[model samples]
Target: MTLVNNPSRTARAGVPRQARAGRPPRLSGRRLAPYLFILPAVVLFAVFKLYPIGWSFVLSLFKTVGGVDTFVGGENYSRLLQDPLFWTALKNTAIILVVQVPVMLALATGLAVAFDSTLLKGRSVFRLGFFLPMVTGLVAYGIVFSVLLNEEHGLVNWALSLVGVDHVPWLTDPLWAKVSLGIALTWHYTGYNAVILLARLQTIPRELYDAASVDGAGAWGAFRHVTLPGLRPAILLTTVLSTIGTLQIFDEPYVLTRGGPDNATLTIGVYLYQNAFVFFDFGYASAIAYALAVLIGILGLIQFRVLGDKK
Candidate 1:
């Protein structure tokens, strides 16, 4: 007996009619649905994010004169090299970055460990109390801190007087102004970092800890061998984020000190805002912005190199 294969049967058996005919199959609505759903997001990103970034780079290369933009090539960047105020702002920013990031992350790590402990009572309440500061508005918190740290008649100074100690200049003296900014930053973001670390901590397997215990490891040994390795990614994440945030710090210094006490707290971000909005020197502002972006990128790379997983 002779058997013949039917085209319809072949097409129905997981072979497309288009494929059999040597033509590409058309994309069905199901396949196209994801792209269609994401199209709006893609369009929004291009218009709002990408377009503005590209325009800013172009704007950096041009100088505005008589309400018209004139192309000046790399002059704005060159000017930044010689600008005394720019260097001062950069120095202040560097100080904050060097001092604040480590202190905040260290505090956050300790908080995370405490929050993760089974022996801790009322964990939820304690966690919420610590995390509440993250939800507070930046300006609101800054203003509150400014009021509390006021040189005369502030609650802090009033309390200090009761203790027979002199009123510490929290936001007035240049050094104290930076210290005050650091304190505000630590309060605001330590909880945020702690939450990130806690989440990562939960993801670590209990079996690993038990195994370490069975192997005669103490709490510190388990933490050093198991916990630290497990927490590397989260630690790196918090470090990078803290570094970036400190580098671009603005609202705190702006509302608290206004980059004051002789420009002690003037960050690159505040200086950029001053150039853009105050001086209306958009070109210089854009240059400052791009310079900041480059600095952030470099620091990010250095962090990755130092902290990223090798295996």
Candidate 2:
């Protein structure tokens, strides 16, 4: 009888009451902790991002005047189609996107590749100099560039005179105004692209380079065969980002030219701002904003498809 009693005691001690077969394990503390930590960030994102997007979409369907709203379905979009200024802005943005992104990416890629070379000296200084324009405040830099590009007495013309080139009307002429904006944007962001490409370059395995060298591959051959493939993803990323940035270009044009010289520098973003803040057409502006989002999404998809095909 004592043995039987002791056996029951041993069995009871072998397993706790909580681990009995009839009940499932409790997850109240363990599973809830992670979600509790992330709840604040989720709330903030919903408040800031999703809320604004929804509000913008709703506003786009209405005609707002003096803080009063009236539902006017699709009228704002119809105005966009009819407006010559909107078309002009779209044309200008397309021109810049076509011309500037390629040039900037090419230059940045060259700079990144050059900087990555072991043959180069003073790499750090060159990198720093290239990145300086980006660090300068946007408005301040725009103001200074406007001064520098002044037609009559600016530093650019002054330097041009030394080389027997005549003064160019950078801000006044439509063609020159667009070119000046492209130059300023390229100058400001090339270093940023270089830094991005350079980081990607570092990840490329050195063994590939060594193997290429052993097989009598010159620098160009190695880069073409190895580096180019390695850099494709980064190139796609920078291209897409630069395209978006150029499409939304406002500050440089706003501060430097105010979309002047016959609205040659006007982008979709500036056009939207002109409608909303300048003309006090909030509904139209909201429509313009949504249109831009759609444009970006479509273009981004095209880019992704093309890049995917190439890969």
Candidate 3:
């Protein structure tokens, strides 16, 4: 056989023949490469995001003492349902969310439009002035504001007095406390949000504005028809982010008023901190934290829905 067989025939004879499959599988080398590149990110997410979420969920369900946990099922959640402080926190948070977020977003939109239009001279300086408060520490700002809004000796009261106005107990009064915090928070973050929306605003085509102008659209008309629509996504994003931030507000209330006068500024975050850190009821705190997370998540979903419906 060795002497008689041709080269191809001899090679075929030496190899073991198997049953033929339908087709040889195609290896998606290019399609698969992206997944391989993203594997590190996936791993990190599993380790950090997923793992922590699981731990928090577990923590929310159990009572812990000296590092040992006793499973209590839905007890934590039930307790939250019955808690009046939780409702008060919810109401305060809701008020801030309703008022502060929209006002801040509106102001930010206006500032962004102004900055983007080149109407404002010394744009960099204006932006810096607006953004400076954001870089200032929250606790530091809270402390500063506490002093500035002090009922008796504060600059704000003195300034009001100069205009023949009465003293406002900004920290001690419930409504005034909300107002003061809202003002401070708005001042601190509106610029940051504006900068974000401004970046988005820049991405909108200048040609659209030019075309609108050609069609006899004035500034307001162009803005309403083109600029506003263009800003919907940015608006939705900022709204969701601001809602979450407001809902979980803590440091400002904590440092400025400590959830006074009589828990007027008692936000969910403050309440949670009080439960966990002050009273050392870790389970209840975890429950409140998770509830706030759920509330924020729901609000985000609602915003997304509204945005979609508009589309």
Reference-based TM-score of each model: 0.93, 0.88, 0.84
Task: Please give the RMSD to the true structure for each candidate, in Å.
Answer: 2.3, 4.0, 5.7
Residue by residue across 1-311, what tens digits does model 1's lDDT show? 99999997876789787987899999999999999999999999999999999999999999999999999999999999999999999999999888888999988988998999999999999999999999999999999999999989789999999989899999999999999999999999999999999999989999999999999999999989998889999999999999888888899999998999899999999999999999999999999999999999999999999999887
Candidate 2 wrong stretches, greater than 4 Å: 1-30, 65-67, 309-311
Model 2, 1-311: lDDT tens digits are 35445776778786756666667656678889999999999999999999999998888999976678999999998999999999999999999999988999999999999999888999999999999898999899999999999999799999999999999999999999999999999999999999999999999999999999999999899999999889988998998999888878889999989998889898898999999899888889999999998999899999888765463
- TM match of model 2 to true structure: 0.88
- Point out the higher-scoring one by TM-score: 1 or 3: 1
- lDDT on C-alpha atoms for all candidate structures: 0.94, 0.91, 0.89
Q: Pick the candidate with the highest lDDT.
A: 1
Q: Tell me how far the alpha carbon of residue 235 in candidate 1 is from the true structure, in angstroms, after superposition.
A: 0.3
Best by TM-score: 1
CA RMSD (A), model 1: 2.3
lDDT of 2: 0.91
Q: Indicate whether candidate 2 or candidate 3 has the larger lDDT.
A: 2
Residue 166 displacement (Å), model 3: 1.6
In model 3, what is the error at residue 163, expressed in angstroms? 1.0
Which digits, one per residue and each the tens of the lDDT, describe model 3 over residues 1-311? 36675887776674444413345545479978999999999999999999987887888899976777899999999998899999999998898899988999999999999888776899999888888999999999999999999999999999999999999999989889999989889988999999989989999999999999999999899999999989988888888889888988999989988988888888888999999898888888888888888888888898899874453
